[model samples]
Target: MKFGLSLLFIIGFVAIHLLSRRMKFVRMVPRSRFLSIVGGISVAYVFLHLLPELGEYQEHLYGDIGNAFWSFLEHHIYLISMLGLAFFYGLEKIVKHSKRKNSKKTKSSTGIFWLHIGSFTIYNSIIGYLMIREEFSGAWGMFFFFVAMGVHFITNDKGLWEIHKEDYEKYGRWLLAVSIIAGWGIGAISEVNELIISFLVAFISGGIILNVMKEELPEERESSFTAFFIGLFTYSILLLLL
Candidate 1:
């Protein structure tokens, strides 16, 4: 059952990447309320689900590492989470810089396009890996994860489409779609150290928060606060109930 469900999730994630460009409602001029809702759901998951999971991971890390050096960094897991956020934040800055420097260019430069895709490919892979390896209560937990991440991917796809345009359609989406499967395949083949999984969870939590924020917080996006609040509260309630 677990294996089957993991495969189902992999399909769902891949489909999101492959089909998000065709989601015409997502291409609105003032930005879509749906996207804002997506932002809220993603943020809610990071805070409600992933952050608590990070605390568990931190405990595991502390138990395992019991060294003086490790003791110095009491919030090492959180630091990793912050690192993940900062990494994506830096990437977003680079992308904005490129756009400003090439204001007349219709498509992002090849270098920037690849850099963006490459980074997201790794990000997607980590998500895929966690889908299989991360502990959950049962199907419901995984289902919530899938829902949050599925919507999150839509927002990410929209952002990437705006930046990369034709290149994203032609190449970038395909790579990201495959990356999920590739990561799942790795998970299926062999499990890595729990320590590594802990770090991955922390890192991805930060990345998700940053990625969602970058999409919603830009004044030009004209994001919908009401929609964002609805999504956040709805998902938060569901998570709490679970």
Candidate 2:
């Protein structure tokens, strides 16, 4: 039953990447309330759910690692989380720099496009793998994960579309879609050490926070605070109940 449900969720995720371009309402000039709300929900999930889960994973790490240096590091999952945020921030800086350098160009350079797509492909793959392998309380846990991530993908797709334009529609989306399935396939066949999963959970928590914030915080985005609050509080309540 879990396997079947996971397959359904994987399909949902792939659909988000494939069809997000058609979501015209999310591409508004004032930064669609929908997107802002999605940003809020993504942030809420990271803080309320994923971060707490990371703490549990940290406890597991305490028993697993023995080296003094490794022991010290294992306790600081937030450090790994910070690294994830920094990694994506660096990627964003590179993409922005490339855009500024090629001001006359309508789309990001081909190299920059691939760099962006490659990084996100890996990101999507991690999400997919975790869907199968991560410890969830029940089907509801998986459902919430799907909802938060599904909306988060909408925001991500909008950003990529703004940067890469047609290239994203033509190629980048398909790669991401395929990457998720690839990750799920790997998760189904192989179980890695729990230490690695802990690291991944921490890393992804930070990535999600950074990605959502980058979309919402920019001055030109004209993001809707009301909608953001709505999504944040609404999702927070649901998570708490769960």
Candidate 3:
């Protein structure tokens, strides 16, 4: 089931990017509101589902580890979460600065654009890899996971397009698309320590929170309260009911 679903997700991920950026109808959709809804759903998943699961994974971390390190590990996932957020925040700043310096040119420097691609390749890869590591309790679990991530990837790709324009089209987008497949292959074949998986998840959650807000919350972006509220409550209700 997972093998089939993961393959579907990889294809869907690429298709969404194309539709969101290239299709006129999709481009006509209110992006701010759409992304806000996505942000809300992603946050719901983090708060309602992922965080609780992290607590369970924390328990599994105990074995022969000393008390101090165990204690540190317990408390430090949150800190690692903060680090993930900060890392992306700083990277975005650097990429933007690099882009600005080359704004007069047709494309940014290859070095600058590669930096952007490299960071987001890692980001997209994490989503693909997590498709395998995430334990979905039922069909709905997988559904929400796909929905949130599919929307999240669309939002992230839109942000990249805004920043890089043709440069992203020429170089970054295909690299990111390929990274998703690569990460899925790696996740399928390789097994990591569960504790490490937990940490990576926590970190990714933090990154998601930061990235979603960066795109959705800006004053320049006009957001639809109706759509945003619908997204929040609908996902919240699903989490509670299911």
Q: 116-179, model 3: which lDDT tens digit per residue?
A: 7798898888888888767887667777888888888877877777777787887677888888
Q: Mind sharing the TM-score for model 3?
A: 0.89
Better of 1 and 2 by lDDT: 2
The alpha-carbon deviation from the true structure for residue 50 of candidate 1, after best TM-score superposition, in angstroms, is 0.3
The C-alpha TM-scores of every prediction are 0.96, 0.97, 0.89
**Ten residues in sequence with the least summed lDDT for candidate 2:** 66-75
Name the candidate, 1 or 3, with the larger lDDT value.
1
Each candidate's clash count = 0, 0, 0
Tens-digit lDDT track of model 1 for 69-152: 766444677888999999999999999899889999987789999999999999999999989987988999999999999999
lDDT of 2: 0.91
Q: lDDT by residue for model 2 over 19-58, one digit each (tens)?
A: 9999877774689899989988999999999999888888
